[model samples]
Target chain A: MSVAGSDFAVRVEGLEKSFGHWPVLWDLDLTLDWGQLLVLFGANAVGKTTLLRILSTQARPDAGTLSVAGYDPVRTPNAVRRRIGVVGHQTCLYDDLTCRENLVYYGRLFGLTDIPRRVDEAISRVSLGHRADQRVRTLSNGMQKRASIARAILHRPPLLLLDEPEAGLDQESTVMLQGLLKEWAESGGAAIMTTHNVDLGLAWGETGKIGVLADGKVQVQEPGRYANVAEFRQVLSSSLVTRQRN
Target chain B: MVLVWKDILLEVRSRELVISVLVFGLLVAVVFNFALDVTPQRVTAIAPGILWVAFAFAATMAMSRAFVREREQGGLEGLLLSPVSRDAIFLGKALTNLLFMLLVEMVLLPVFAVLFGFSAMSFTLIGTIVLATLGFSLVGTLFSAIAAQTRSREIMLPVLFFPVILPVIIGAVEASTRAIGGETTVGLGRWLPLLAVFDALFLVICPWVFSFVVEE
Candidate 1:
């Protein structure tokens, strides 16, 4: 593994993906580094999930060179997969299993030997230790989402890709999730998350990077350039008004 | 190795697959009992075929649910995101399904023997059950994973499973019939080879095909 610089964790060049005849991602280029929390903001059908899936090795790119953790995702997906964790809309958990069981199941999948301790730590980290033995199907939507987060981070991969992690989450839950992301970034992990909530994207501070993806193209990339909270809010409101007008 | 055990442990607690397969197998056996009007001797002679049929249908039901349940809970993507090899996932699912199918077979065997008035305590019959169930579950597991991603997954599973496991079914039924009829080991020479061939083919093919099926 070659760490070209202290800042780079992912380098994607000319990444292109197509489903049948329709292209989903076209010549996409992005680079992420340590302690960076990047939010991909996009609306429906804009290829947010497709881009994340390709980056996570859940889908293949038709053309281009992409590298995550110094391994090419297209050619050596398994190596890239080892360094990344993804959370998508689907909870991807066994409903019949308990919260602890779900975490242990994934922990073992990643070949973590101290499974019981890891499961307990993850459950507590998600603040679900009280419901650890409860069946996942019995939990509330927010609780289930937390369980999904616990499973995704069980291996502590350097790169995290979350597809709409804030969708449908209430304010309190969203705040808690944001705090978790902040801590993860502080610990030198890089995160790329896609969200429909523009407010959540703007709330991420200096360590955060924001990208606007519309119609499969990254229209804007803002890295700590918003003047202040008020200015960020104004930009967000104006963007929404413009979109509504269009 | 850990993935396989994780699947098994989860199944042990939930017991969903086993319960479904057992109930379905019993229902099929009862319906067949009333549907077929034959003497005790004739029923004993045909018991192996009926047993295999029940297992085939019941195992398909259990196997399809193996991955579908994960997909519904959003666990499939998590598993895909893990560093585990795709082949390990395939093998883990197949082995877990095999374990569930075997559990169903163990419970069904005595009930089947009682229903047909055949002796249940035969090592040869148990061996045949093991071989047949393994082959059926392997094919069933792979097909279930493939069908789970389709639009009509519930309807697609049996459509995909049966056609592929036809040879295994034939071999299992033939081998089982010979064993139940008190035939010597010589009678299994042909069917056992066929079962082995099918098992080897599936163990090789399912892993390769699974990488494609799980890709979004």
Candidate 2:
């Protein structure tokens, strides 16, 4: 099937997926424009990673009408993969390889020209130039996350699909992420990051949209509409409580 | 076995996997030499079986580790997320596994020669090794990727591996025996062409199947 919109970074309608008998996501609809940032918040096991996996072409939806970067994920996965970058809980860097080596490897995989220059630029972009020579196993969690971010943007992809990018980040790494996100917005590239921290999620989309996945569907709102974080927290707790009750 | 990644991963890799395969192969040769009592008359028959068994089992065990690093470090997802064709990913990995298995086989061949009382060097035996290793390594590499995704990968690999590679095991043994016996036409001529056919067939099928195996 042909994608209707050429502008949306991601568009999903009535997406459904399940593991065995447990339904993780059903009839879920969401969209992110190329110039917007979307922060997706959900409780543990609420299919946050599953949704991101579908978008990244790592997992297939049981049923859905979906388009990522104007390409159907299953029909044209390579095209979709080319248009997107992904960062999950794992660093995706080889432990045996140095940080610079990891970026250069990805640069070659993505068929980027001027690889040494791109690797240098990406390493510097994440402020990993000093430690770029070290193997990934030697780096701390924060440094690895920074290197992962470098790998993600090594191809200069138009969209970034991040799954809980802030889970264990320290203050410095978190601050580095904020700068990256700010630059991500400024570059007009789209991003959909799954996060559990309400404050962090809301902060990610400062002026953009924040979404909550509950009962197999998402309810999105502009954080600007809420008076403070507590309001959004109340709504989130109430919805999750309602789900648990059912 | 080695990783594929456009051959760049070779530079970063440690020597552990190579050492593992070589040592495992030599262990098989040593055990077989002590376990069996073979004179020159039986050497042609029994030695070929022992040699291929060493190569097949050792290569199977070693090739399974090829994807462990990728899966454990979550780098497989990174590869899947790339714009590179899935077929290229599979072929590159299968070919690299082939390369590594050949390297270990070269190291072990002389050891097997001393143990089994056979000539160390023969073009026909080398040809048989290359063709047969290619077939099994392609199948092994594909199964490694599949088994790596599952929870009981260790159990899954052998359960899935031995049955599929039985043909290569038989073909290599037959061809190696003929190559060692200096029969230029009878068994080697028949088995070599057949082994090449199987290699070509696996070379085509494994990569295509690998695309689906990696998908969720």
Candidate 3:
């Protein structure tokens, strides 16, 4: 399907990833365009994080082609990595360093100049300016999550991948995070966030696409479209009942 | 280049690795002072071996902690996702570890001089320290990266590192011993070349091996 401004930020065709004998992502085909927010929904072990890792060039697909910003992730991972930022269950921040120090450290990793300014801007953007100098280990979970988000965006990568970014966040932090994500999308950055919160996903549905992944495949790709909320709830309930019976 | 500098800067701030290594090297030097007592004439003969053993043990201690900070805070994945070359990561980490090892040697040199009553400040001894520590850190950093990924990483680091780095330690200690003894024998010449060869071999191999260790 042709997306508006069809210049895709991330595109994968027949991407297959497996560990030993167990397949995690099987023949998965996905495309995400710039300026779009894509929320991927999947049950645990459905390959959501695996797909994100492969897209971010942190892991290689066993078969087929995957590209981020037109560079093949496996063959040209560094080039792909330059354009992608990832925040996963792993905060990927040094606990000994202050939040600002962590961002500055990552900024240098990206070979970014004007690191102080970039770090300052990211800290302000994440609304953690007051706590920038606090060690990451000392921060609360919500604060640490914000610091992680700041670090991920320090270089302003065009593509952002977040795996369960809202896992331990409070309601207020979740709202703030959602607002930041909306701003990032509005500013022409593409994001793919995985979450189990259907309500949060629905909040983003107006300007975002949704994919339901199950059993190592994208079972549905409904873009800016979801079945009626009540009907979806009913379907979900029946599926849970079926699972319980089995 | 940037990542390497970052690690160096971070090390400068914390100084944990360097301090631990320096203290450990001094402790080893003290222990060796009594364990390998020698006549004044033989003091120079045994100095290099003692220095290297101290440096290698201290370096391994520091290298194992290189990733501990990253692993504890989950920053390794962030590093792996960056555009930096894997070789740069390996070199940066190994160089920082080497720098800490050098710091340890710096402290040990004076202590050895005072304890053994023989100066180890000669240019040859200094050169040996530089070369030997490079070889030691190269192997230590690579094995430390591997150990960080496994269970019981603390215990596993030295267990895995000591066996694999036997050649480097032997080559380095032999070269240092020969240089200290003021013996320009052909065998001494062979040790220097052998130390250089091992350093070069590890420098080339560790970066490639590090990529596999960091891969998800």
Candidate 4:
């Protein structure tokens, strides 16, 4: 539960992983600072989620090193877990528990003091207070996603790992999420978010890094590399097509 | 404690595990009461075996149910993603299963007594039940974690659970039979302590094994 004295929020180098005969992430390298956000883009079956899993200490890599908040994931996974909050595709909320109950359970798991206050704060952060008492199974998909986000940020960790966090969100909810994330980034928390929406990813990463994952590697680009979204979109499409051809 | 609290809350809300296992245990006793040709002479011996079988199958059913909620709903992943240690998760789950099995046993023990025509309820029998249930719950919780990772988990749980817990079941049957027959010497001399030994051994080993296997 102790934070390592490192400037970077996440660091990975020469990382490799595969499922059976299909390689997902190979020789992938990434680094994010404490106040930065990285929006990862890839094809449908690419290794974006896989990489996030490895970074979050949920999965081990086949080779290379992973450091989250300056601690090695393989050796000190609990420390890494203590420092990061993840919003995965699964929602990770118990269907039978109310949104507040789910947050309370997770808050207890993280060993947070003053759980009721923390739970209320997280629900407010996600704007889920109106539906906080409803069971997760009874909520809309968008509402459930917000609840999941609430659970993720309940601990107020230094890092956030989000996989398709905006998948089922409506326009307003998505904007709210963006605003929350913007505030999170501004408050010196780091995040790595993956999405299929290229324009959205570009917009989100405009202040940090945008990464295109293709052919077992990531091509990371800084915001200043391109002047506009269309140019960046063309470059990304061509890179993906070329990688697919290879 | 928090994990167990959540499990208890869920069970309280759903009434799934205890109710299903209670009904299943009762059905087993009923079926055996009719299926077996138990004369007064054989009732002492035969009833013990039937009771243990009922308890074992019911405990196995409970074990399967325990993990299905977590696995089917991605709750296990959520647990892993949290800051809790694996040992806490294993102990919490095993304790909940033990509590649940004990609850089912309390209701079924008397019903079995009525169905099989024996005076029931004693400290010896209760102690024996606790020891036996502890052993199997410890082992079953570990195997349940393993089986939850497999495809045919419904079949896999019993297939993996029964053989590993045979000693506990046998000990339970022996101790229950002696306790019912009022053979304090035999019940205390061998079976109860043996069940305790198995429980202790599994209490140490299962959590260790669980820590190793719980990681995917």
Candidate 5:
């Protein structure tokens, strides 16, 4: 299910990041070629979000060569940003603005032409049309997740970084998110998502890849390595044990 | 342009920052009016200081609101994730806060004039307001971004904000005092330059600091 081309959409080598004196994401290496989804599995506070942030050009690595969409995040963040969309735990929607208004704001920021039309289409696509006019703060958690999905896909970026996109999502929303990721992958975009729910993350597809991060390092990663959820779980538990032992 | 418009539209839709701050500024003036009874002469003498103090306080409200809104909703990260340059984002936020404060000051000045029974409807006073407010908003926007990252942002913002902008407060009060006292030429020549220099310095520095801070 992986797209062709050795040309990677994202590349990181020996990436080292630390907050204060505590090291996170130590000597990490990751790569995503075009049209791939790498569901990064990790325990909480294991620097999955930090890795995504570095890839999204929101943070710099302490010691690493990081590139996104052919641009170094540190040297050419604007270019990297232009090629990416990120949805963290927070929906990133302005509480005061309606869903439509938030999309328009982002649409304008991305310089997307026909903003109103695009916003309408995005809202409707996310099944948020009924709540489009409601302030985002007033929306339910699931609805806000849908709104954030709309925002992320508004620009149709080449790379999407999602930290816990399924956190507040319902079953239906989860299915929608899967479909959205599938569509994005089909369209030659790459995504790196971090989630604690190994089952949902593994369910991305048989063609997708999974990486388990443990002890500040990506311990096990292979494309379509887990044929089923049981296999993924077995490896994950082993990794956790290894992490604890180390 | 998009950044500026987003902030303005957000403010217009919610009316949270401007309305609260305008009310706060007016309330400060009202409280001052009640606390001290003064003749028109005395009003002119002390009203500039009082008016600026009110504006300064109100501006902090707006500044904190602007940064808090971004931090609370993760809007800053959203903005950073966008293709827009950090400088553009900084300018947009600073300009929005500046516009918000200017609007509050505009509304408050008239109410202040009526309350204090004094006339400060001079172009010089308005210019001083613009310059001093530009400086205040510039510095406030930067500190707000910095403070927003801290746990105690409400306390952090004021602690970092006021001391840095004391020069602007002094320059604004001095300039407004002269303008309100009908000595516009002399006062503006002396104090407006100070305000202008302060404004110019931050207009360049704050955006740079904001770019650095947000990236961190």
Candidate 6:
């Protein structure tokens, strides 16, 4: 509601995005602030990924005022990019480069001076130090996902845009990722992650927001509510039927 | 500088583009030898065309490989998400493609000289090659980025690339033909100017086009 204020990390007002004539997001609005992790739940083709792309400044909205860290994504993309880290469905890792090389590459993008030490720290953070020298193509899908997380957090961006960061992760990696995110949020950083797994999505960040997107709108937005997964699931299923029928 | 270094480093480590382009260019020259059966007298006439055609094909191979690598691994989005300006990224990639093509040409030129029985070393010839390769790589890098986003990227790159680069190839071939004919002064007159103008035009245009393409 108060997206323009400096307290908020992401602010979207009247956002609309479409591919050609097919509209994906229609008159949607959302707000997120630092020290919170918002888990967005949506059905397939509900424009969750498109929304994330717009927010991350990789795609433009057809019409809307979308800002990340108080900078407009369309006009001030570079400024917005400097403040955010995105981990999408794609691992975004070079198949030929080893895990350490990939991390070091991203570190250099962020202008980190001591790349070797930072790369080692990130590799150990994701628990991938054992396979640091291994090519990404040779690593497991779960390991690749960990490497993506490592790359994203290397610069310690203020806002994190995660589109299904947990998709390929195993139980141990998932737990480690959650721990890292929790620590980040506790330290006043913000994140918005989209997921199909309602259980895992709802379980994230107790005091944060749970938004259900259906039919190109935020069908159910219960910010600071639905602390438990069972309650969130019940509301989500009913909201889906009601929103689809409407 | 970092973007260009990363690309060169990746290619060096992988050895994917250089090895394949070198072999491909050599094979094209070998094919030309058997197909044409040119005598020493006819070497200057046919060799320039053969050399440029071979370079064009090899350059296209490198162009496709460079652009597609980022998309195949989803690294393009990571690049777009970085704070670096799009112009820098475009220049870095163009430089890398140029470097790859030049490296292949460096090897192929000497081999072609041996096979065709012509002395290939000349300042004018090297100058023409540099100018032509710059223009070729700039357009190729821009179009390759455009093609990489499409469903049929491999098919799309050459379709978008070759027609646009005809002026460059023709200019290079003509200038190179004269240089090999031992007429350096005349070769630098019309065709070299053409190559320089084309290179300068793309040096301004490609980066702008690349920024627009990646922004969308």
Top-lDDT structure, candidate number: 4
- Candidate 3, DockQ to 2 decimals? 0.59
Question: How does residue A236 of candidate 5 score in lDDT?
Answer: 61
Question: Once superposed on the true structure, which residue ranges of model 2 sit more than 4 Å away at CA?
Answer: A1-5, A222-228, A237-246, B1-12
Q: lDDT tens digits, residues B121-140, model 4?
A: 77888899999989888988
Global Cα lDDT for candidate 5: 0.83
Q: What is the DockQ of candidate 1?
A: 0.62
True contacts kept of 1: 0.86
Candidate 6: tens digits of C-alpha lDDT, residues A79-151:
8887888899888898988998888888888778888988888889999989999989899999999999989
User: Which numbered prediction scores highest in TM-score against the true structure?
Assistant: 4
- Rank by lDDT, descending? 4, 6, 5, 2, 1, 3
Candidate 6 Cα outliers beyond 4 Å, as residue runs: A1-5, A223-231, A235-246
Candidate with best DockQ = 5
Cα lDDT tens digits, model 4, A1-246, are 224488788888999998887888898888888888888887766888888888888888899888898889889989888888899888888888899999999989989899999999999988888889988999998898888888888888888899988799888788888887788788888898988776677678877788888878888875557897678787765544434432
How high is the DockQ of candidate 4? 0.67
lDDT of 3 by residue, A28-47 (tens): 88887778888877766667
Candidate 4: TM-score? 0.94
* Better model by lDDT: candidate 3 vs candidate 6: 6
Instruction: Sort the candidates on DockQ, descending order.
Output: 5, 6, 4, 2, 1, 3
- TM-score, structure 5 vs. true: 0.93
Give the runs in model 3 whose Cα sits over 4 Å from its true position.
A1-6, A221-228, A234-246, B30-47, B183-186
- Stretch of 10 with least lDDT, candidate 5 chain B: B179-188
Determine the TM-score of chain B of model 4. Answer: 0.96
lDDT of 5 by residue, B1-216 (tens): 778888888888888888899889888887887777666768777898789889888888889888888878788889888888788888888888888888888888888888877676788889999999999889999998888888988889889988999999998888877777775466468788898899888888888877889886
Worst 10 residues of 5 chain A by lDDT: A237-246
The per-prediction tally of clashing pairs is 8, 0, 0, 0, 0, 0
